[model samples]
Target chain A: MNAAPGVVAVALVTLATLLIGTWGLRFSRTTSDFFVASRTVRPTLNASAIGGEYLSAASFLGVAGLVLAFGADMLWYPVGWTAGYLALLVLVAAPLRRSGAYTLPDFAEARLGSRGVRAVCSLMVVAVGWLYLLPQFQGAGITLRSTTGAPTWVGPVIVGAVVLANVTSGGMRSITFVQAFQYWLKLTALLVPAVVLLSVWAGDGQPHPVGGDGWSMPLAAGGGQGLYLTYSLIVATFLGTMGLPHVVVRFYTNPDGRAARRTTLVVLALLGLFYLLPPVYGALGRVYAPELAASGRSDALVLELPRIMVDGLAGEVLTGLVTAGAFAAFLSTSSGLSIAVAGVLGQDLIGRVPAGRRLGGVAAFRLGAVLAVIVPCTVALAAPNLGVARAVGLAFAMAASTFCPLLVLGIWWRRLTGPGAVAGMLAGGVCCSVAIGWTLLTPDPSGWADTLMAQPAAWTVPLALVAMIGVSLLTPARVPGGAGRFLARLHAPETLDLDRG
Target chain B: MNTPDPGNPRERVRVTGPPRRRTPSAVRPPIDTETRLGGMYLRSLLREQLRLAAGVLLALAVLVGSLPLVFHLAPGLSSAQVLGLPLPWLLLGVLVYPLLLGLGWVFVRRAERNERDFADLVRGADR
Candidate 1:
């Protein structure tokens, strides 16, 4: 095949991920181990894995793209994505770990004492999982179609295959190892090229930032739309980080509440350090690849920047490395989402089966893997025109609206009854879902509602919280009796017994 | 006093004190005593978690809520240019994330410290 260097790089990365997953399978044994590595993952390793999985196609490629388009304003995506973890750490992570549940649905059932709430959580998990998955598939499609003259469907198919293979092989135990490895790969890919490109730009007489006739000022160029977009982004990134299923599931891998909190701290540091680089790439892109700024395809900003600046064999090598890293982002994130969605769906829906059915469990999980990967792939392919970064932002918004509020109320308030939980979820879910649905369906959609629909987290989160509080307070008698005790389990220090299992 | 009889491993486990209490009748195993005490201990722990979670969430809510206000207040930012973007835009847009990271880090560190302290207490009591 006459593949672009990117195609070859992506292929090699996929192969590596497969090999690693196969290797990870050797350590797997029981169901608990599959879901959460038997809850014994230490802080350092867990943090590395979280970083790996967390740095999705958005982080790898979208950051530079946002920067290229919006200039300094785009810096918020990386910052918010990173900092969202703080919310997770303080409000949900340690307690979530303490809940001893394998998935979000599990947490919901335990906390709210309602099968109904778990069911609502189950549906949202799949929706958010699919929304998050859409970008990974889209990024893959972009990578493939850009690099090779193949059909766009090829991108989603290839990523879907790799994700299915890895997720089916080892689940969380396997994914953790693979993600840790990919984090380093992503770092190296971006770091090495960044250093070389800076030197190249420096040697070529160091062009001034803001390039030629383009507006370099943040909203000066973007105008009113800019402020709207920026704050919208902040809301999405900050809150959306809390609701992401893949990221949340990682907390379950910690040995106990304390370990989970430590893991979050490490995640914050790793993310902060990683985020420092993307802005440099964007700033550099401004000077090196001016056309990306002029045209609106800054999403392709990072890929094109190196080639625009570098030349000959060196450019090819650098492009190849970046391509691999981009592929790593797609694989790690898709795999993480696929596993999380699959786990939740498989357990809550499928596991309630005839007893002693080992084959049934594995098969159900595998089927869920396919479902998780395919839905996003289809959605991404269907909506071929979205900016990858913007699409990913939508996913964050929906998550923030739905999961962020659910978790916050569920964990902290003893009086959050099942009916109240359902009401809040329905209100938040309907509004956000309608907004997302409208945004997706309406081509040529524009203006404030469009912006709000496109980024509903800011409004929807508060709406949900209010609804949850209002409904809960009105019918306080239905609150679960063990809410107090269960809350304690989530907050208490871990004993070695909890760690051992 | 209460200690674990270990007669029933699944449900009944000793939580505090020695095994028996002096009574008029033959002494009953302190199983009920430990279970009740354990229940109370567990409730307190949950209360602490709720307290910590609310504290962190409220703080984040404030930080996130203030972005538009803070950006409006910043000097020399032209509503025009700050950080290569609008002051309000950057605050609402890009600033929220690093703020997220900062807030997330603070919450997680404090939470972990809380958990760590709780764990130490548990370990200490065991000893």
Candidate 2:
């Protein structure tokens, strides 16, 4: 197996990412630019950047793998993933932008006027970011081992290093361009190969995917457990998109409420277009490479299918293209997650410490970025077997449980006090985290516990919402006096000349 | 009644000094009052925005929440062929994305329109 093509593709992507990052760095002069691109990013560009960052290894490789293995049920992942933006568009996008907060914690503190709520939000952001980043690193490892025959650890180290370099040096300004460019690169990588492979499949006679009745049937297994899992997945992905630390952070780049809404709209189209290609790969994989599914390496279906379907040089070239896309997937997502985590850690932990006070804002952010990338890289190396899509789902479940309620209530409900926010977040965080831990530790479980633990969003989300509303209702007087003004600012258009200041 | 005392001078001559009009400055809006009015204005704006958000969410809930029931109730639909692909694959894999994009487009347009209306209201109130 010649590794030259894989190596060259990976190197080219890394170099391009660095070059773009450096180019964007010229525009990042102020702290504000480092954080939110000075809140001046237009809708189209921001949407492209969001799409770039949002479609991680999970979307690129994991979805196709899951689809190939589980069939129609796995389609929920992409559907819910795209529809999550609809939820965001409807619920949080504009007001969250209008709130004028740089980060999730900033929104929390601004809305509730409580340091405790801010701290909880900061913790959740970091938790979600790390959980999401873990999969990217793991997927990278898998991609490298399969593509270049490199050791699994080399991929993570390389990804972590490149992401850290980009994030720490240039921050959001640089990331925006790199990610926007990555969206196109990834789209092309997947699209061109898909077109070629589909033509090949047509030319070779349209053979059907080798599977039984269960493959095409939705909710055909586990009786009620299957139904429960489906809805839980729906709950997670639909609500979870708004809560993702990286995704929500991008909304802050929009110039105003309207721009934020427009950006989300464009992101929906961009994501919708991108998602169409992955399932094509999945369906094609089912036809051409059923053995990969049986061998439990279905995650490599996208990378392997072009080669299996095509012949000789064309196949290798297609493989190289897909390898580049996968590499870009890991780099772009890891960088976005790293930036989100680093921002939180820099502001909440490092920058606030007396020792770190000597370090300037950039230095603190750089230090935070290093810590952010390292923890997940270590975890990916330690626990390498978690399915990429499944891990990403857990991250979504956790977000839906915690930040979803926080954002919704904080924006809409005036009675949301600091204590309520804290209580709700803790309840959701603890429940979801425990379920994730149980799933990780137990390996294979039987009956209801397995279903419930595997997909906890359905219950945990409502619990968090109930807890927040309940606690807030019980302690009405604790509601921040500034809540009214903040809500007003969030809802009012930018053109309004109210004394928000 | 006891004695209209001459020393009292008939209640200090009942001085009539041009009815002592209040200064216009004293009647001007106070800082607290203006803020109170601004708060009211903000509350109305927020109410309108919340209504818009709630309406959109309700529509989405109905659209997406029924998917499971539809598939479960009509199991045959999933296996049915559509354009040489399984119905579930056609619907979830292909058609669902465009639907999502369409929903997003409608929501963004409406939400922005809501904001525009809100801005108009605020501007009108300011005047």
Candidate 3:
């Protein structure tokens, strides 16, 4: 009864991984299976797997906490995340598969016919992947430290080790199964406690969460800064969805364009369903655990609420359930990203040089998995907290800037030369990197520029797209043959997979 | 590395202009109009791709550019009572996602349709 939810969540995650990993063990064998489950994953199953991996620690803990502190505006984070897949489904998914590539770099090289483009794509994938992974470890540390009073590093270390174990064991194949199971586990974890807490809150007179300063609206609300911040969030969520490397890579696991579309639809529904519950927790946190808001770190809303709202055994069990789901959030996302990063590393870095022959296939993936997990885990601890959802928002901005324009131009515009693609990535990367560097390093900036720069995605995606299209127009001669054809494929995925007129 | 299909070589692109020269693929084989599709069909494919690409680009631009406009245009709307719920609740809580979902679905379908049409054109050429 005394054991905290954080401790229980970790245990549940371990059990779920062992069970699902075994279930997937039978299906995984060849390198192809390891990489993409042989591309036969069904829409429904893949949808759940997508949900499992995509619903990160931010979704589980940070978002609800954000809502508790920042009102309904914070809801956009999850909504955008869910909708981003829809963009992927429509724009990139089927064509990506039809391109018949293993990674984003593979697709870039295939489209533009340039190794240099591939190298840049690879580098961006690693960068975005690392940025995205940082929150998972940070959340883990927060969960563990808050629940059990353990050393903060314990959370990230355990998260990294568990993620490494799952990813190295079977690549995407094993991780897919692991993720799908965790999705349900996470849903139940959050929902069950929520239902109980709501019942408890209602029992205690159903008052709204109070304690202002931390829980109410922003200080500069209705001002230029507020307006700019909101719109910037919209842009990042809207465009950034298309560019996340791990998420985009998942579409390749489907059998065809039709399957990819179907998978996206299912993902939208599943994600929408899952997203409905967390904000309720945040709203409830206002009533039950307003102290968290005043003290800062409202991100620990889930961990803190159960004890204040419910005491003794009931609270402990509920906390454990939340912890398990929280752990699932960390594990599924980290594993998915790790697999993507490892695939890129294996094919581009290790495969090209042949030095990694000493570590083959799963072994290589295992070693790569460590890179995928540990670096971010260490960073999560050493670096100052970005606040889970806000940090994730930054990652989205980067993805939108660099990958979103690259994919759109590469897929649709025949005039996109190798030079244009290179130029676009460089411009987007530079702007985004500077913005992020400024945000983290300075944390304070001049008026309009600071607002514009803090939320770079709003303008950066456009800047990159404009640069790409402008440069592309100048060098129509560089447009590759079949550019039209390639675009047709990207837009019309199901047609290729079907035997219709 | 997997060796590319070897059959493409013998046929190479012949530039239609005065150069009238053979276009070569640095490695595998030069891309040629290997199919029997007439010039008219190739022209049609090019036209259709242009139309679709333009539409997709316009849609993305409009979506990205209009954020400031949407909030600014809403009359005396405070942060509350947007479509029954408040603006923040409505936008972030619900409508934005569905809007995004609709747009994303459109993008995927359009992209897929474009792909299928191309594949068909190429297949028809092959036929």
Candidate 4:
């Protein structure tokens, strides 16, 4: 395969990203722009940005791969991911935006008036960010390796550098533009290839995959374990999206609560449209590249399929297009995550310190960006691959288990106290981390125990919620005096003339 | 007697009724959310939004969530073919997206409407 097209495509994408980042830099003058783009982004642009940032390596490359490897049952991944926005839209979007916080920890602090809860939330944000970033780095590594025969380390290093540059220089303002552009790029890349591939398949008589009954049916072989895994996945993705640090931070960019809601509604549509293409790739991969699945290189199915299915210049060009898309996927998501993590780190840990306070907001945030990108990039290089989609799913599960309860209860329940929020977060975070450890350490999981541990969201979310509710009820006196005021601010229309403070 | 005392400030009594006090421009509670009435408004808005959210989620649960169980139980449905593909393939892969988009549209519309209604009520009460 000619590597010229793939290499050139990647170079162009990186250049475009940097140019756009610099362009957006003109608008980013203040700390507000650095953190939340001055909270003035319109619904359509914000929605596109959210879609871009949200669709990481998992949606671009991992979903099709999982579908190829696991067959019909894997469709739930995309479904749950899209529906997760629905969950966000109806439950959290408007209130969170109305909370008038730049970050999740900020919301927690404002809501509970407890630095302790804020500290816990900050830590959770960093944890989730790293967990999410790890897969993106790994996915980039594989994408570059598959496309240009580059060493795996080269990919993570390149991605980390670009993300760090984009994030540190322009912050959220530039990232919004870069991400919005990437969403369309990703959509076109997948859509065009899918159309061509489908036509090719039709010309060849639309031969069905040979996997037969097991591939077509859900839980045909795995039975009870499969059912449990599927349901747990649903619960995680549906709830987890609201809690993702990168995703939640985007809501703060909206002009108001209503725009936030509208942004999310548009996000649902964009994601649904983008998601419709991946299953097409998956189904096509099944028909053309079954050997890739058999060989355990399913993640590369998206990158390799175009070249394999078509011949000559067209094939190489298609390969280049997807490689660019995948690279954009890595860059956009990593940039968003880095900004999110860096924002929290800058505000809570770095900027609060005397030394960092001297460095000031933008400088501290730049340093935080460095700190955020380095750890994950290094770990991704040294650690073994954990299958991009699965690692992402784990991140979702963790988010679902921990922050999901905190956000939901904090927004809706007036009786929620600081101690209750802290306890609930710790309960969910610790248990979910245990499950994550078990799943990662055990090479071969078996039986009900492994199944439960493997996908812990189904149980851990409820555990966290219960702990919060019970503890809050027990410590009713601990509820903040301003709970009613805060709840009013969160739930009320921004147009209404009330003192949100 | 009224016309006779033109000199020496002739008992000029201004009938103003002690500075009529402007009706206080509709005295009402400060709509501060910390107040009980404000809290009640908040609670009502929350309850309405929560109910809307719950309805959407339940509909989603019934429509999409039950698919796995339905497939697991029926098996025949999974095997059934639609346009040269298995039923599960078409439904899970192609159809569910529109369903999700539709549900999202409905939820956004209703949630916004609820907010609009709440705003009207609050303004009405203020008046």
Number of the top TM-score candidate:
4
Report the lDDT tens digits of candidate 2 across residue range B1-127. 3335687866544454654334333332222133776666666656766676677667766776777788888787777898988877887888877777777777677666776776665555545
Q: 1 or 2, which is superior by lDDT?
A: 2
lDDT of 2 by residue, A187-263 (tens): 99999999999988899898887798888788887668889999999999999999999998899999888888888
TM-score for candidate 2: 0.93
Measured against the true two-chain complex, the DockQ scores of the candidates, in the order shown, are 0.24, 0.31, 0.17, 0.39
Residue A166 CA error for candidate 3 (Å)?
A: 1.4
Off by over 4 Å in 1: A1-4, A211-215, A221-228, A353-359, A441-447, A495-501, B1-75, B78-109, B112-127
TM-score winner between 2 and 4, please give it: 4
> TM-score (0 to 1) of chain B, per candidate?
0.54, 0.61, 0.48, 0.74
List model 3 lDDT by residue over A137-252, tens digit each: 88888888887788888988887877776677767887888888888988898888888888998798867557643333322244667667777786798678778888888878
Off by over 4 Å in 3: A209-222, A354-363, A444-446, A481-485, A488-501, B1-76, B79-87, B95-127
Give per-model CA RMSD. 6.2, 10.5, 8.0, 7.6
Candidate 1's residue-wise lDDT over A289-346, tens digit each? Answer: 7687687767666776777778787887888888898889999998888989998878
The DockQ score of candidate 4 comes to 0.39
**Superposed model 2: Cα runs more than 4 Å off:** B1-44
Candidate 4: the clashing residue pairs are none
Best DockQ goes to which candidate?
4
Question: CA lDDT of B125 in candidate 3?
Answer: 43
Give the Å error, residue A384, model 3: 2.3
The fraction of correct interface contacts reproduced by each prediction comes to: 0.39, 0.72, 0.29, 0.73
